[model samples]
Target chain A: MSILEATRLVKRFGPVTAVNDVSLTVGEGEVVALLGPNGAGKSTTLHMVLGLITPDSGSIVLFGQELARHRVEVLSRINFAASYVDLPGALRVHEVLDAFARMYAVRRPRERVAELVELFELGPLAKRKVMTLSSGQRTRVQLAKALLNRPRLLVLDEPTANLDPDAGDRIRGLLSALARQDGSAMLITSHNMREVERMCDRICFMSHGLIVASGSAKELAGHYGAEDLEEVFLKVARG
Target chain B: MTAATPPSAPQALTLPPLSLAARRMRIMGVVRRDFAALRRSPMRMFEVLFWPTVELLLWGFVTLFLQTQRVPFVVTFLLGAVLLWQVLQKASNEISIAFLEDIWSRNLLNVQVCPLSSVEYLLGLVLFSLGKVAFAVAVMAGLAFALYGFGVTGLGVGLVPFVGLLLVLGWSLGLVGIAAVLRFGENAQVIAWSLVFVVQPLAGIFYPISVLPAPLRTVAWFLPASHVFEGMRTVMAGGAVPWDRMAWAAALNAVYLAATLALFAGALRYARRHGRLSRFGD
Candidate 1:
């Protein structure tokens, strides 16, 4: 079963169309990467699917329920993490995680928190205020929050951005394991082609608010007669 | 080989789905989280206490000086006006800042994604503001009593209706302030602190509406807070509770609250449509 299905999603800001007629799905345990240049509607489509922004025209179905009609119910089973959004600075990392756990109505919140703490290796930073954490530390905390609900559908925007190589590899490994072991589906956006190729099951290329190309990394490289996914991305994005 | 060192294992844990009371808990959680933020920030705590006390002292001494001129009921009138006005200012300021805190911290998107409804979030801010109102009341009322011999209890049981109407009025204005901040972004943040004063002259806090010019009185009459102050002055004049004025104030406040809520709803819709929700503080 698909964890998310978005159809004909269109969002226009003033004279600009941020997303236009985009359709996609993320199946259970699948990881989908949305690749595009800046302002190419990748984040807009993600925001619409997350129900953070209302599409000018479209429908979003998550867990087989319509998002606009059942946002609260649907959102509880979903989680989102973005580099652009930060937790309240004054809250200790544990407090931030606990608050999200409570907000999501997670079962056994303290235990869930403890589990995430171990999973993300968030031991030493849990007591410190979120503002004090290094970018990599905060990214780990954000990832921990995304897993707090054991979300059925996780939406991550640039999940490994700004992290050192070691931290980045750990995050990629963690997300891959979540999909394999927990049957979680994820929709991720990242400019890092290697991460995309490594972590995503399929890649969708978008340009000017439209999904111009989509396939597995190998399939896309073959489609463009390119040597690798990065070359293919450059070719598609340039066009 | 027999002692391959028995493997150690962690405890098995079970997690049940949340009960129906989860909704109530979620609402309270928003309030708890903001207060948690406040507790972590010493500067915020100092500002919360400092403003009302300073305003009280400044206005208290001003009332004291005015009384030396033998102005009729100057002590009661000015002190009562300043004290009560603080309710409107503090309550509105607290509520708006509470909402702004989320946006300023770049946490709006995180909270919006949760199962918590906007109304639930709003209710949390209202409750938080009410708690702030309680704090301001204790500090300002104590200062008034000690410094100028002004007694808030002089309104007797009438204090309930007076405080309630003003609070609702302040909340209405606060909702408007928050909506503006959401609609206009961080640049509009000053509205949270200064919007109350824009209406202060019209509300006639320190003087009766009768003293205002004709055009201003007409404008003041339309403000629910004006009727609240009017009713308060009547009570201080040893008249009845001015239920008519109080009722007028309540009715007007209801309209204002409804309008502000509608405006907020519209603003949220606009923000979502424009993809502004996630871009706040950028």
Candidate 2:
């Protein structure tokens, strides 16, 4: 079943069209990657999907309901995280997680927070204030917060951007396992081609506010006449 | 560190929609997050306690000096004005500062994208601000009695409506400040911190509206706070409750509240359309 269906989403900032005629969908348990160079309207598209930005013209259906009409009901079933956004810095790790767990109306908030604390290896850092944590540590905490609700669809923007290689690899592995074992759908944007290749079931390449190409990693590589996803990205981004 | 095993599958996706009780809990979540931050920051606590105490002391001494000049009932007038003005200041300042904290922490987007509606988020801020105002008022009232021997009870039952009107006016101004910040981004942050002061002269916090020049007095006439302060002075002067003044303030507040709420909603729409909210922290 389609977890999200966004059709012909267009957004403009004055004379600049940030996202134009973009249609995208994520199915149950499927991990989709949105890839593009800077200013490719990737973030705009993601924000529209999250209902943070109102599209100039479009329709979004989530879980087979119109998103505009059922925002609170639809949003309660999803969550988002981004490297550029932050949890409150003055709050302790556990407090931030607990607060979000409550915001998401999670059942058994304490247990959910404790479960995430262990899952993210945040046990030792739980008492530390969010500002005191390293960038990579903050990334883990954000991911943990994003899962507090056990959202059916998760939207992530550069989810592993700040993590060290070892931590990043573990997170990718954990996210893949979540999709495979838990049947959770995800829509993510990342510039890391290898990470996208490893985790995403399909990749959509965008440029100039439009999705120009989309396919599985191997198919995209073949369609672009490139050796790998990275070369394919270079070809699309440079065009 | 080794990766921990992933958790088991989530609960059924077709779970029931959020009930009204769950929605209220989400609002409380915003409040809890703020209170947790307040607990961790000594400076924030000090801000709540220190400034009100200092303002009271400053005005208390001024009234003491006036007493030497044989100014009859000056103590009640000056101290009463100080405390009432603080109520207005704290009520408005708390709301704007709470909003600013979210922007400064780069957490507005995180909060906005949740299931929490704008009205719920705003209600949380107003609720949190009321708590802060109550605490600050209690501290100020205590100090006023201990150090100056001036009791707010002297204002009698009139104090209730007086404070209520000021609070509504303050909330209206705070919403205006939030709308300004939303429309203009961080560059307009000064509106949150300084907008209250812009209304101070018109509010006639320490003086009668009649003291203003003709043009300014006309402007002050439309301000609900002016009627509140005028009514406050009448009460201190041993007159009746001035129901007419309170009525005027109440009616004005209704209009201001409606207009400011609409302004804030419109500004939020503009911000979302322009994608300014996503960059507010930057």
Candidate 3:
């Protein structure tokens, strides 16, 4: 497992410094949860790491190569999924997956799509346009697309943001299995405390565009002398 | 013991970097995805089939009343509309509007976070829309000939080439419209609409350019559509198509299209520089 490091990263939007001298490291086979209150610069950090936004200062390095210099090389193995981002509405579920699979250059897309269909239970709705699908179904499809290339590093803004409890549970289980078997590392953002407790190996607590605390879920919880991550989240978020 | 906990934990997880081939494939992926969207879209059917038919009937009535002594502008427009589908501006605008819809839906970041770059995304969209416009034009042309007997007096000889020229010209202007939308965003709707509206009255789609009122006549002469329509009428009317006039029109459209492409390229640079390329919805 190599290191993914953001060194002294700074970002400013006009008069505002969104990310203030923030730095963190994510390693292979590890899941990091970026927990923060609204407007805490979590998404901004993820955006900078992906090269979607450039920092005014500092740099992000993946596998020992600077991200800006090796963007194409670094990004090909990267995939992201979120409840908010969706495939084109005009595409059928099957077509959506097929297109992404082909885009990712999966050796045999039909086979890969079939595997996704089974994994996500998307077969029955394969013929339907994506816009017609419920949010949960769309989330599942997005996840299927994200996993199409067997990505190395995955970033999920809110993979299960709008799912029913049962569905969210299923997806969490699937993500757990994927992490255990494929050893894919992830950086996820969520407001769900229980999900963080169960899913993250390391939790980063962010406030005002800086990472104030990062450690194992239990460590942060115990370090703050809190009963659970939810209480720890409150203390950090209130700041 | 109830549970065995490991004391040592590997610090973090990582993935190997991607190769050149892998990177290219990811970009090509966006093109394929958009193509799939095109196939699934039903709006095109309405645009090519229903909209043209409706236009033919509705405008047919007006042309009949206005040009009782004349043949009818609807017939002329019918023929023109077949080719107008290939207008570079129209195809370009379609892709632009669709791009906005994606952003509004917040799905654009999903693709961007993957391997697809902004330029690659635009390329896929423009190419797909161009192909679609071509297909629709072909379809409408075939239907016009079958239903209305629009032979164009053996204009078929140079017809394909003429249509080809028009599409190339259209592609350049269409791309400019796309640039407008990407830059000005919602405010650019007026510019996009002008591409369609300006062509209608000035291009001589229905009536002869000579028939346009005195003040509007000068404006008509400045438009590429008038030249295209004049060329079409000359070929179909069995005239030599005034080769010199045709050349001038072609030259002018070429220059216009080139300028439009430049604008789009500039808009792209602006997006990249401003860090707005990756921005989703407003």
Candidate 4:
């Protein structure tokens, strides 16, 4: 069984169906990118997979357990990080990580916090309030929060939106290391096709809440007969 | 000195009550975050401290001028006025800010997505807001004691504890208002405007309840704050305690609080069912 799986997911807002009967899967150590334009239900599908929303119709399973009913059971082995929202700007960087670490109940949490701080190069900013950190630093703190649990399944939405390319590159490297070393699976939603191409083993192009196409980055590009993944994204979105 | 295992490493660790722990952890997380925010912005703490003092000053002066001469009821009224208003304002502002803050910065999504349930969220808000009210009330009491100089007499003791119930009742009402605000957003402003109308005059802040018109007096008797004011005056000024009357007020407040909590829970379920409990913080 996959670490994460969704079948025939649907979400509706009055007359508009935000996520329309979408199904997908992610296995151990795999990285899948949910690609689509704005309002194309990429985030919505992620939400259902994460068990944040009860699907109008369909099921999401994590380790063979249903997500909607077993969110907490699945949640400990899973954690999500996103840039749009944050770990409360008021908390100090160390405090935020300490708190999530405690939430995940990391044994001997202080050592775990120290390890993540060192791993993310977050030592310098530890004492400062999160609000005082720069955007890139905040993203790093968020990434640290997600990893605090040592989650087997990590869902990241636009994980590096505000960072400089250097910071972005470092993050990409860190995520690759996690997947390679820890056998962690991730489902990332990003508009940056180039980053997606570099990080993702497989990509699913979703449009109007359905998976229009699915394959590896190069495979998708060649199958769509486009020069790059971005063109494939544009082609899928335009359709 | 062992060669590093290929990146695909494996290790096993067991978990404890992850669900229950998540709720407690999330609430504690909120407390940590709020306290941190408080420290980072001394200006915000100052604003909270300053506004109550400023409002008290305004009403304190108004009471001084309006009294013509200090009748015993008016003196007692001023004390009740300050205490009761403090509780109401404290409760209203905190509950209002809870959901509004989430919507404001769009952190509602982050919080909702966590393993936080409606019961956990409500418990956190109640515990956190009441904790703030208690601390602020103590500070305000100290200020009042210093400024007013020992005026009222014996058994001024029970008054402090009695005032706590009043605070809870006021906050319960504020919570109900918060529910209405979440399910229907436009009413927030309307509720704000109505807050002043409902609380100030009817709250029996400026005059004795006996002096109010017969119908308004009947209405005032039903308010938990009114009984708190009356009970405080009885203990402080040797006025009548009116146990039967205070009993009724406590009873009414208990019912109101239960109803308010019910409403809040119902509203949450409705929002979730409607998908207005949106995960993206929309």
Candidate 1 per-residue lDDT, tens place, B1-282, comes to: 011111112121212223456676666778778778888999988888887888788877887787788777777877787778888887888889887888888888889898887787888888888887888688889878887788899877778887888898888888888888778877778887788988899998888899999999999998988887888888888888888888888889888899999999998888887777878878
lDDT scores for all predictions? Answer: 0.83, 0.88, 0.70, 0.72
Whose TM-score is greatest here?
2
Candidate 3 chain A — worst ten consecutive residues by lDDT sum? Answer: A100-109
Clashes by residue pair, model 4: A181-B7
- lDDT tens digits, residue span B26-129, model 4: 56656655555556767767866786777656655665665667544454457556766777777766666655666665566656655555665666676667
| Candidate 2 lDDT, B88-157, residue by residue in tens | 8888888888998989999998888788887888888888888888888888998999999999999999
Worst 10 residues of 2 chain A by lDDT: A101-110
Kindly list the per-residue Cα lDDT of model 3 for residues A59-99, writing each as its tens digit: 89986889888876677667888665777888888888887
What is candidate 3's lDDT per residue for B1-282, written digit by digit as tens?
A: 011111212231111225455445555666677667656766745664565555544554554465676754445555554445345345645665556656656666666665555556666666666666666656655655665655433565556546655666555555666677667664775675556555677667655789989889888776666776777776666577566666767787778877876788688555533456455464
Whole-model lDDT, model 1: 0.83
For model 1 chain B, where is the 10-residue window of minimal lDDT?
B1-10
DockQ of model 3, rounded to 2 decimals: 0.32
Each candidate's DockQ? 0.44, 0.62, 0.32, 0.34
* Model 4 agreement with the true structure over A5-47: per-residue lDDT tens digits: 7888888878888888898999999999999999888887887
True contacts kept of each: 0.55, 0.62, 0.45, 0.23
